[model samples]
Target: MPTLRRTHPADLPPVQRRELWAWAGYDFANSGYTTVVITAVFNAYFVRVVADGADWATFAWTLALSLSYLLVAVTAPALGAWADLRARKKFLLAITTAVCVAGTAALAACGPGSVALAIALVVVTNAAFGTGENVIAAFLPELASEDGMGRLSGYGWGFGYVGGLLILGVCLWWIMAGAAAFGVDASAVVPQTMLITAAAFLLAALPTLLVLRERARPQPARSGLWRTSFARLRQALLESEGLIDLRRFLLCIVCYQAGVMTVITIAAIFTEQALGFSTTESIVLIMVVNVTAAVGALVFGLVQDRLGHRPTLAITLVAWLAAIGLFWFAEDRRLVWVAANVAGLALGASQSAGRALVGYLCPARREAEVFGLWGLAVKLSSVIGPLAFGAVSWASGGDYRIAMLATSLFFVAGLAILATVDVPRGRAAARVADAAIG
Candidate 1:
């Protein structure tokens, strides 16, 4: 276990200082999965290479993700609860990351014929990666003061977008032109791609291990961790009338996140299958989206800090609706490129602001528990979103346009729900929760 080094609450004034950067460093670490593995490269590789000929591979992959997220939803709150009680955030984060990194690294054993093994590894990797994100979420309050949460969240999002973009660029170049540079045959490049990606995941984790300080002492016994976590989550959610606001937030997140996840998870498939782009072209398109997302994170982080989280998130919801509408009418690969960039912008804006808003709404003391619930919101949407996209596409005679159109409703409904919920009310309630807990 890493040593717990205490940071005084008085020392958190600089919104973008070293502590915050160390916090955001985790984003840079995890975005490799989102960019290179999930969005751009590995997903495409799976559908095109590993999962080919099993007409069921795409559906199976989606199902695997859905199952993984379902597990996350069930387990995250308890994990958060356990971490809080035990002061074991670092331990949990390290363990979960190791699972993900190991799974990602083991992808080297997957070849054209190892579909079952590939699926197992991906499932392990995805589950651990998703769960680890929740553990990382618990570390945020230690890194930033209350007032700085929005900008800090935005910075994390921005950093993640940039990191993912940079890594994806390298992976793409390696495929397109780096084979000769590395003295490797073009045929062996894909596995090498996985190897590089795996290395990135491990290296990215090192900063968090080295820099972020957790001052809390672990509970001696690790027994009943999951059960205790669930019990505490229930208590957190139902402990007081104050939780009603969090309920509203969770509901809104579910609807909007479903749309966001659908669009992002299905992007490469939409590009290649619908727009008739080749693998390399699809990857380049995904890269363009990520770059634009980095820009959007920067712009919106400032906007969120200025105009407030709800309005910024609402604007993102509107942008998401527009992006989906664009995709529905998308005629050529060019339009897909346009939609990808637009969606990227909205994706970054919403994620950055949404997380910040949750931080703002939850009391600092209860942050870990609340973040666990937030993780539940995130993972549950993972189940509904991608599965919905896949199911819609499957049912619509393979037309992805319907799936795109369907996502617009999610955005609109979520926006409406958010409009009714008062951000100030949530904040006030959270303060009460904090005082009571304190």
Candidate 2:
């Protein structure tokens, strides 16, 4: 019988281990924003308070997310290509991180009925968050070998869930403890929580900037940024025969990610509105979900290396379909908790598997550019999913259950498309493309 050996920090050279921790630290840092601002806290606040229960709050909130993702969809590939050309992934990451932090902090000023200001800030912050996600993910190919990519990506995602858990825990405490802790009125809780989230992001993200070195060799100067970016984008889209499988995989990601993004963006809002959960209850529920998600990422990440990326992803999508079905019919709040945990498991598995597969399929020399395409797929899903949900919710007069049912179609379609991907063939293409570039 053959025994399997697990990789650990001690198994890596000191420098690579340090880089791994740093890379994971950024996940930890940015997850606070995703948890507190985008997924759990702010979305609920925006709908329930900022927009004051208007029928259009869901629409407006989803629309803001759509706009932000639209911006990322348009510019992520260009910016990623330019960053790769310049070997400036870290630089771009820093700039986007700053934008997110500043925008989140500025949300502190948005008092009651400040819907316009809140939306604008969310757009700016979310766009920066999406851009930064692409840049950081492009580093995965540089950091881990194909055999280790799933575990490494899972580690980062697991760490991210811990970050979300910690930050959400704090926010929950603050919200539950009430005005005495922060010396502010009850109404100020959301703004104060936003400030805490921003500070957490800034402080936790420092290790990445300080420790993760860019390893890519810069190519000689190309045509100007715009020309080169557009040319590269066109080539990646239309000219790279090796990327055909990768392109198909990305299309699969587009379909399922729409469902995933919709769930992430609106789960808290759904719990609040559909189940009559209070602010505190929603925060607590999300914190629990984060815990399960972290466990799922770590467990499935290890499983992915053995089972292969495609199988792992397919399994998760099936889980997603089931979870969404539960959400659609879950009249009792306890059932929502069950659905939340199911979603948590699927969320972690899908994210870790997808990123690892992309790392496996990306050519060595074009990590940023290829991952930019990955980002474009993700951002496009972000746009389409939220907009679809928002539109449905609006048309149905905020019938979130119907919106959730609609989301499951995306998962089913994605799973169907994903079945056709040839993982080994995709990997071979990536290697061939790398050799040609070399």
TM-score for each of the candidates? 0.92, 0.94
Pairs in steric clash, model 2: none
| Candidate 2 C-alpha lDDT tens digits along 1-438 | 122222234534334678888997899999999998889888877887888889788778888988999999999999988888888999999999999999999998887799999999999999999999999999888887678788889999999999999998888777767777778755567788998999999999999999988777677555777688779889888874767889899999999999989889887777877779977787888899999899889899999988889999999999998898888788787888899899999999899899989999999868888899999999999888878887787799878889889889899999999988899999998888889877
Q: In angstroms, what RMSD does candidate 2 have relative to the true structure? A: 3.2
Model 1, 1-438: lDDT tens digits are 221222455644333356567788888888887677777777767766677646987887787778778888887887777777778788888898888888877887777767788777877788888888887777666665556666778788888888888788888778868677778755457776777777887898798777777755454444576666676677766765676777788889999999888877877787778878877787778777877887787789777767877899999999988888787777776777787788989988898888878877877555677888999998898889888887788799998888778778889989988987788888898888778756
lDDT of each: 0.78, 0.87
Indicate which candidate wins on lDDT: 2
Best by TM-score: 2
Off by over 4 Å in 2: 1-15, 180-185
**Distance (Å) between predicted and true CA of 54, model 2?**
2.9
